[model samples]
Target: MGEEVHGPLAQTPTPSAGMQKIVTKHSFFCLKGKWKRGRHVVVVRIRSDRMCPQKFVFTVGVVAFTIAITLGGQVLADRFELANGETIEGTLLNPNERPRRVWLVRSSDGTSLQFDADAVTHVTRETPVQKEFHKIVSEYPDTIEGQWKLAEWCQEKKLEKERHDILEHMLELDPDHVEARRLLGYSRIDGKWHKREQLMAERGYSRYRGTWKTAQEIELSDRAEQTEVAQKNWIVRLKKLRMLVDKPQSSDSAAKEIREISDRHAVGALMLGISKEPAFRVRSWYLESLSRIATQEAFSAIVQIAIDHPDPETRLSATERLIVLGPHQAASYAVASLASEDSARINRAAEVLGRLGVSSAVDSLVNVLITVHTAVVSDGNSEGSTNATFTPSGGGLSMGGGAKRIKVESKNEAVLAALVKLTSVNFEWNPTAWRSWMATRQSPADCDFRRD
Candidate 1:
């Protein structure tokens, strides 16, 4: 009977009656009877009418075998090769070459294959499998995705030129790809390119672009959902702010956002924003924002930043903000900060204290003046200049000195200026009272009570 096997798992048919059985023995043979030199082996032959079915069976077997062999070879060839986001397999080829190549051999069937050096983009031949996996994972940073994948892979694989070409092509395909935006942002920030963050923030696909959008949302929303989406949006903005503020290069767009957010939400968001920023200018901007908003909740944090920040400019800015927000409370902190070792900080504190017209600071102001006088006199005489020559007998000495001298005339003049500012706020230092106190002390030739 004729028979056919069609499907992949179909079995071969048994032989027909026409087939004859022939047995031949070399070294070994199955024996129902023992064979000797004179013995004859029995063979069976049968005639069959259906010859076509037998022929078809033989043909199907040959075709199945060929197909199996072909499939096996393809599987082997695929072993050494990997598509995008796939893992490496089989024996590695030339690892030290510019583009790494690898070989694959099928275990089931002996078939050898070769992979192109460039195709092995992400696999690292240097380290163990686990470490290499981590390295590859790190190669794909959060900001890099889409068209730059090839370039990123090339870069990770140390194919510099290939990476450049891939990046160029990525720009061609999508000019505003997120990966391109991220790389450009990093390069611009590193190069100190002006408005790097602003440019990135303006780009819709940039990683930090979400921050700008979220900031706008927060500004407009009277009540934002505290759900994951809102929190994630805020976190993105916070990260952008951190990036611009913590790095040496500042982003003006980030600064502007911070100022706007702080002005709108001075209580918690502004404080949180300021806490995240490490750069002095960013912190200064944040403090100024707090001043503009001027809420009761931010008063303490502003004072703390004024007192604790290492940068004098930042501290001065914080102090100024605090003064604008709450003049009465800020005056105390300003007066205390005037005793700081940092001269700039002390000067700033003194200026703010004078501006605020804190009567309580008069005693501290007098102490600062005395300390300044002692220091000036101690240093002035060492330069072989008599204090009297600089001080006029009846008339007050000029407050200006050099360029700064033009800014202020004398130590006594600065003190007088402070006194005038204080007196303008109805807290006066009686010149006669200071003169009377001077008279109680022994007067040196350099000392002039008249100027006092």
Candidate 2:
């Protein structure tokens, strides 16, 4: 009995005096026990095939279940319908729906709300939304909502043609439409719009078919009759406007009315009136009106305005008009203005130099270019200076000089470019002399110098 053999039985260590004992059964039918104190315990258990596999399987099941739930929620959210002007936090249930017609969905207190599609005038996409909007407006021109939206969109987007067309169409639909009328009137006076009108007139639509019939009829009459009536009416209006300019009485409303008629009806008639009465105020107004009209006949009056007006701004404006008009008369006035000491005049002279193509003024242009270059170099280091440095080279003048030597700036290059263009008109006029001049000027050392 003293040496009786025992199976491999496990023994537990003795508990401390303050510890409590606990016992449990194992699956293998072996006894298991633990020592516990308060809520803490120490236990030992027999390893069994059943217990080891069950714990591993339970953990894998829970992880798979959580993943399935997450994926299913995403799929459901993406399939639901969304309203316009609504926003959703979840993924769209159907991404294939047309974005243009679709609206956003809003979730409030866990419920979704739908908004009317018409509430939104525009649909934004990742591409050129403006171009698409214009196309749609063009396709649906008769829809007032669409046209109005398109007009506003054109204005905001700076689509000049679209804005013009939309407003024109609106006026066509309702001639008395105040907003459309105002925009068209304003457009008629704009430089770009006037240019378009001129282009249209050249293409044989000076006046719209139904509109301005009386003016068109008058324009198509015999040239002599037209001229005589225009001249007579012009004289009458001229006398009235002159009285208004001279007296400036508060009661002279007729003069204002005549001016309005001139601006709206016949700018030429008003100009003829101004030519007879050369009051400074009247001349200024007349010149401004001609600039707005921008016709070839206005060139003569514009030149007179540049030369005879006392106001510097009026003179400068006339010079600008010459640049735009570019008639032979404008060229003559610009040539005279080249001799002016005023910087504004000189600048205007520089502007018209290329346009005028007056090769005889080459010496004057060269002097101007040299003076501008010198002023620029001298002002390079000045503080608190408002003057800008001038450079003939920036205006396409070619240069050549040795290091340490000041370069002589010349307008020969610009003058030559202009001559080349002008001589094309009649190359046989002075072919021999022109060719010789071109060859001599091409050589850097052979440029002629003459003191004015």
Winning model by TM-score: 1
* Model 2 bad stretches (over 4 Å): 1-221, 244-279, 307-314, 324-329, 332-452
Worst 10 residues of 2 by lDDT: 27-36
Instruction: Please list the residue runs of candidate 1 whose C-alpha ends up more than 4 Å from where it truly belongs after superposition.
Output: 1-105, 108-259, 263-288, 292-324, 342-345, 372-416, 423-452
TM-score, prediction 1: 0.28
lDDT of 2 by residue, 1-452 (tens): 01211211123343222222232221100001111111111121222225453221101011111111111111112212122322112222224666544343322212122223454343223225433432344244464565667688878877665577777666656665666766766334433334445555665664545453344564665555766777677667656656665565632674455544433234556656554654556655666667665555556667756655556566666766676666455666666765554545555555555555545544444444323342322234444534333444333233333112233443334334444444342222343555565555553332322212
lDDT tens per residue, model 1, 58-173: 11111110111121111111122234333323333344564334432222232222444455444433234322332343234332363356455656777554355445445555
For model 2, which pairs clash? 78-92, 78-93, 79-93, 83-103, 83-104, 84-103, 84-104, 86-104, 86-105
